[model samples]
Target: MLLASIIMHAAQPIRKERSAASIYHLLQGKRSAQTLQDAHMYGLTHLFGIYPKLSRQLFDQVAASVMNEAERYENQDIPYFEGMTYQTQTESFLYRLLLLIQLLSNHVREEKRYIPVTDNPAVKHWIKQWYRQEQHRLDDWRNAIYKELYDLLGKLPPLQAALFVDRLTGYQHIGLTPGQLAGKYNIHETDVLLYQTSTVHHLLHHAENKAAIFPYLAALTNQPVHKTRTITSTAQKTRTMLERGLTLDQIAAVRGLTENTIKDHIVEMAWLDGEELSRRFLSDTDASIILECAAGAGTKKLKQIHALLDGKYNYFQIRLALALRRGHGVEA
Candidate 1:
């Protein structure tokens, strides 16, 4: 039987489920007058899916939408007034249209939909509270993702860090496209795409559970204590070097890497360790100034933070202060 038949046979209310196709599909596209019908059958969404759970509802929605489109096209295709001068889509054209509908349905499967809500006081308060929690959760996942991608980039030979930063920051901050990045960085377009793909692959390789983040970190963090120490020794060494009063420049020289690389090691470590180390190296006076500057700048980049402070703090002090705040778990 068609999977759609099975769903009808079971006659169960379906919600979210687990499957490979997108749950976001039905939320998109032109639903027309078919939406209500689509919402009921559910199987239409999963014509090609395994709707074992929450995803079953998602698949059903898709199946309904696809079938509706097919029905609409078929009903409108030809008229029955024998000699009337009317035109209709060709059979092949209709056939191809249905194919396009199925293909396009999956186009936005990877994206997430926004919650449908309004500003009722209780609803708003609930949403705000929920957002605070989700923001923290998403932030954690984003951080882990950034770390894993960066760790892979860090392993690359000379200029890897610069390349990663330039590509990502420039694209995100400066709005540079892949083609533009190629021109700006003196590299090939293919290399840019390949690098992006490799980074994503690396991220997926360290899969926590699936999607962009949620499950992956969830799974990883579930591991034992020893497994949680995923950070590299370079960060630990940088911490020791800093504690021993080796300046960034000195540490860079000793490690045979750039000053920026050393700084990255420190900042990332600070983020990982949280505020535990902040009180040790940060004086209350400098801490206040750093936090103030961080609030004004709203960023952690050394150059950006220094500029925001109008040059009162030196490079090493700024690096430490920023790391201190980051370690202290104060995002601002």
Candidate 2:
């Protein structure tokens, strides 16, 4: 799964990748509506990630209301998003759900209040012309995607191809629900869903492997490609300190932080860099020892690992090894 996840690499859109503070300012410092939308959005891109099935008792009428409002305003300008154009029918639906959830959450959190976004005018005169232009280009985009899919299916074994073909129908390539496809194939529902997801992961990467699909993928996830997960401010500083050849204690003192804190940061840096977690911070021998200990423990719990190693490796060294083994919190 991890290998498949990183086969394609692309920079996420500036809009999707903007910091939380930037999002607040973008919406003109509103009641965290954009931030809230971002929270739900993490699920959109990881279509194959593990999430608990929503229980019937937890279903909200707000979702139904949002979907209703979305259908009502389809192809019309939405006041809630303040006329953001990247928003298409699907995006508006999700955004509407976020908006209603925000209202309901705020009402529950503090006092009665509603935050509404002002609507801007649609690009009226040029709207149809622009849409027609997009409609024309849409064919080129579809052709590119289909070409890649065809090539991928061509390379796949027959069983996999057959499993995948069942998902598409007619000239339009409409998608079938997993339950429908599962029944057709006489396979477990889970197996059908998993197989479809595996093929999709392959094709998505094939389509996106060459370049970052900005608004195209952004329109789907509403979240960035998440550059920060692999590198951070403290990690950056740690690298610079190591470059200066300053020892951990010396760097910690200079930076006005505890040596332990500095060590933790160094380990985090290692985690970010994977097997390349620089020899300067963690020697090859020390890292190997930590890795061996962790594998034996079969868990990443700091104390359990610390105990298993029996003082051979410190907490920080153990952590760095764990990070490297776990692919260092990176998708690519």
Candidate 3:
């Protein structure tokens, strides 16, 4: 059953690679600018998924460059568009950078080639030959480019830098881009992004330590502690009420206790006899009145009973003694 459910839910979204030719076609005409810009933003969001923190750093660098450009173009005489220029330019530059990064990241994410590394002679010989021929420099090259982009973005204001990074890195948690997550999850894009970001943070922190991971996993899986505590507290309350003068029927009426269980507790505590305690307590006017008064009796009555019982007698003995003193027959 579990395997079937897992298989049924294992579906991942099919992502079509955006080819350079297709992008070039879109960029050819006047109406193509907006289409290209949208495509770039989509790619940037995906790039963040591949390397969240790194992508964010690069985004900030692009934003800083745009801000510097905006500052140069600013007209102090015309205040209306001066302040808005930086934001507009920065957004445009960020979108373009995101597209380029996405293209590179997607290629890496889809790559299937792998060469095993082992201590065996044949594998070691193969690796040495491959390295000497420089057959797989893509990893090193990609890392260098990513680092360069990040180094450039490190100049923006802390808040702007953080926001730029989050925009890209935040989609990985939900395994979807902000737009796709929002549409599929039936929530706002921002909400899906934030949740994904939070999940990443939690997973990162917990991954470092087994103790931390266990507690987090337990919480997610609904651990038994919370349920156990609730049940124990409820039982304690029920025991306390039974010890106080609340008859089983009255306790049941007030606390939603069942009649059979209440009788069992009364018998267990030796407050009433094993057989027909409910009938006797209910049918006898004097016993019923005493039980009712007991329900409202102070802790002093409990203390008195406790003192009378001491070690020589239990609660049952004290109750029998009290009944005899009051001229009430036990047989009744």
Q: Against the true structure, whose lDDT is highest? A: 2
Each model's TM-score, in the order given? 0.28, 0.41, 0.19
Q: How accurate locally is residue 172 in candidate 2, as Cα lDDT from 0 to 100?
A: 23
Candidate 2 residues lying further than 4 Å off, grouped into runs, are 1-133, 137-145, 169-174, 210-269, 275-285, 288-312, 325-332
Whichever of 1 and 2 has more TM-score, that candidate is 2
Displacement of residue 215 (Cα, Å) in model 2 is 15
What's the C-alpha lDDT at position 278 in model 2?
A: 49
Clashes of each: 23, 0, 2
Q: Tens-digit lDDT track for model 1 on 265-305?
A: 65455444645655555576886897677667555455776
In angstroms, the error of model 3 at 200 is: 25
Clashing pairs in 3: 56-165, 61-153
Clashing pairs in 2: none
* lDDT agreement with native, every candidate: 0.42, 0.44, 0.34
Q: Which stretches of candidate 3 lie over 4 Å from their true place?
A: 1-91, 111-141, 169-332
